[model samples]
Target: MKKGMTWLAAMAVCVTLAAPAQAADPIKIGVQGAQSGDLASYGVPSLNAVKIVVDEANAKGGLLGRTIEVVAQDDQCKPEMATNAATKLISDKVDAVVGPICSGPTKASLPMFQEAALIAVSPTATTPGLTEDGKNPLFFRTVANDNAQASLTSDFMLNNLKVKKVAYLHDNGDYGKGFADKNREIMEKGGTETVLFEAVTPDAVDFSAVVRKLRRAKPDIIVFGGYQPVASKLLQQMRRDNLKTPLIGPDGVKDETFLKMTGKDSEGTYASYPKDTSTLPEYKKAREAHIKAFGSEPGFGYYNAYAAAQCLLAAMEKAGSTDTAKIKDVLRENQVDTPLGKLSFNAKGDAAGMGLSIYQVKDGKFVELDHSIVLE
Candidate 1:
């Protein structure tokens, strides 16, 4: 009887000792993006970027000695699909989430993330509505919103290009319409005339009809608001039609796909993006690691995604707990040094003092022209 009692006590002590270890499970970070839709070029790279950061964090002993696990889902660029993905992540009880690259999907899925009290951070969603509503305090973005890019692009057109009269062509998506409206507002305010504004479906390859209308306007320039694939098609059609006006667009049209799709027609096309690649020693080191891990060059969205992940990890470290509320507060207050320079969120969960860079496609690559912060 005495021997049995001693054995039982030893077993109980072992169980108690193992309890803490069992409770220290890996922390899961959910990533939502359009992995299989028209935006896959952006989404896949963005997802890989998140993976690189999480892997590096784990290799360096992770956050508070807990390994980071990425749980990714394809939102497919649809609102319903995005909401479903958000719900799935919330059901899995993720510590935080890192995307739905497109603006429409992000806006549609915001409510689900807010209800779950999850810290939803986006690397590429740039619609002004996300931040303008003053709702979803949990929402955060690393990229400059469309409003900034629009104002900058508008200013460039009016002052430098001396393009007083311009025509606007947008894909009519959330991203397209948002940029068009904001650019029009700012261009008019800046003393430039917008002669025509036209919207077209994103998947429509035959933009000759739209091109005809734009040519009729006979504006000095045409500004397109859409991604590379559609933008490439439109530009190709414009070239085929012998339109010579300079074509300007937002970051959505800035990618290798754009160049490939538009062929040699991409030359001289302008895009507004975040600042030129940060070559600071720290960012250089991180970039090296990223290239080594992914075995490829990171895109514009990659750096932003990496920054978002680092910010989340930093917040988790500061809080010393995975509690969403505490992490949110910590993130709002802390300034993390990332590849994109210092990152700090404001009351609206926007990266404080962020700006856009203007670039032109020269020799089949995005060449930085000017890096400027939009003053609100």
Candidate 2:
């Protein structure tokens, strides 16, 4: 009996010693956004949110027993810089990329990611051209396209505000131009003529010339398609020139930074946002945690970034692999619950059922209106 027990113990020891230990490779997620530039307001908050999501996941044993690491790059809101950042990430062997925030940069870097078979998700790149024909298989966005906001803005202007003519101004970049063009099309179709269309250089210190032109045209409303920095400067200049025609803007201007820039000037100014969920229980909890880490509330773009990070990690967990193809398949087959509510991507990599709602700057805050327009 003693000899038989010894033999069994020896066999168990040999089997245990022969088994190979599993390797714990860190999963790397590349985060590209404007860390320094006018658009940093959009990028910085989103990145902070991404960090929160990653940290939370890491705290819970991570996904698939691997620690997640985020390698962030500053695109500086430039196209060439974005391409270079993507190349660096590819060389670094990142599992996925989370951004390229602005539309131009996103467009520029998307082909590289597609060629490399690396999945990318954009939180703020809202141009309709990105997924128009359903060509991009490896790219996705949490935010709705500009068409969604354009529809809401056009409908609100024509049906509610009763604005017959609008003066359209854009900053000549992909994001600004896309919004301006889509808004023009939607407004024209809704019986609102675009009286004056002009392009302004982004980051121009003085908009006196543009203001003078707008004052002469005197449309019922003025719509500016650009980031908050330019939008605020132009709005301030318009106020100085006394061209207050109830200025409105796209999601780019629906930010606290814009409110601080314009102060009382931002009052009565309307902007369309993805949606406001400040009152939701999930959002409240998330925002509290965010404030504890970042000292502020989440912005319009933050929710999308946070959602993208969570969705990416969740996909990896579901697939039990960091392979891009598996993650992409999981993304298509699953719905992710986030602070922004339930999210699912469509065939074109656009967030299905994602929509927009209008917000008016009132008392130094963006207050959601009772209306919303959804474009699936």
Please report the candidate that would top lDDT against the real structure: 2
Best by TM-score: 1
lDDT of 2 by residue, 254-335 (tens): 9889988888888899988877666766677678879999787776588889889888988999998998889999998788
Q: What is the lDDT of candidate 1?
A: 0.84
The TM-scores of all predictions, comma-separated, are 0.95, 0.92
lDDT for residue 145 in candidate 1, whole number 0-100: 82
For candidate 2, what is the total of clashing residue pairs? Answer: 0
Model 1 lDDT tens row, 183-233: 888888877788899888887868888888888889988888877778888
Candidate 2 lDDT score relative to the true structure? 0.85
Candidate 2, residue 209: how far the Cα is off, in Å:
1.2
